[model samples]
Target: MAFENPSREKIKELLQQSDTVAVVGLSDNPLRTSHSVSQAMQQKGYRIIPVNPNATEILGEKSYPSLRDIPEPIDIVNVFRRSEFTPAIAEEAVAVKAKALWFQLGVYNEEAAAIAARAGLQVIMDRCIKVEDSILIPSGKTKK
Candidate 1:
């Protein structure tokens, strides 16, 4: 399946409109990109739901093992897992009705992205949420 990259404008609009993001494969270690990015988003007024089998808690939020486990709606499923594994993850993300799928830097699954896109979900690959937040917010004005 072929999928077009989401336009810059659509990406910006999604980022601005979303508040809760599910960080799939999130780790407990603060040094990890998953942890740091989630923390950054949290500070920026976005609720970060940590999804990992290894972690019981992270950033003061309860961690779920999968998108299906999240009781509340997830605006974005920010994937930190390997690119090869994203198809199943994308399927789960779709089944759970997440509004979008985000793959962190170095993570890109064109197949999975297409599946999500075909399901009417916004798809962003190889972009950092922290970077997006920082770039979108004006200097000296915190989003949170």
Candidate 2:
């Protein structure tokens, strides 16, 4: 069976309910798409955890080398890496017990989606999290 992402309403609800997003491949450079998108999400009140091995910190949050290293619960695992790398990330997300796995625009992998889905993770592929939040949750605040 082909992989399908969650519905718009489901995604909206996920975005509303989620509090922490662990950004895999987040960059310290402001010019990068990962950095800009993560910054916007941070401004939207969600706690952004950077998961870049190279950077010690990004967007004022401490950076972890991998998902397994994050000490706190991760509501979402947002990935900015290539499609080929996502399957491993999905495995890590599942291992970390993240609620959702999101692949940024231009990043999509059927294997990764299947892995996360099988583990009961809400999988979103080839979509921009920042755009989704701006459109779905225009208020930029998670519902309490």
The stretch of ten residues in a row with the least summed lDDT in candidate 2 is 135-144
> In terms of TM-score, how similar is model 1 to the real structure?
0.92
Q: Write out the backbone clash pairs for model 1.
A: none
115, model 2: CA deviation in Å?
A: 0.7
What TM-score does each of the candidates earn?
A: 0.92, 0.98
lDDT of 1 by residue, 1-144 (tens): 455667777877788778889999999998888888888788878889999988899999999988999999999999999999999999999999999999999899889998898899999899987887678653413353
In order, the Cα lDDT scores of the candidates are: 0.87, 0.96
Q: Which candidate wins on TM-score?
A: 2
Q: Which stretches of candidate 2 lie above 4 Å from their native place?
A: none
Tens-digit per-residue lDDT, 1-144, candidate 2: 887788999999999999999999999999999999999999999999999999998999999999999999999999999999999999999999999999999999999999999999999999999999999999889447
Local lDDT at 2 for model 1: 55
Residue 126, model 2: Cα distance from true site in angstroms: 0.2
Best by lDDT: 2
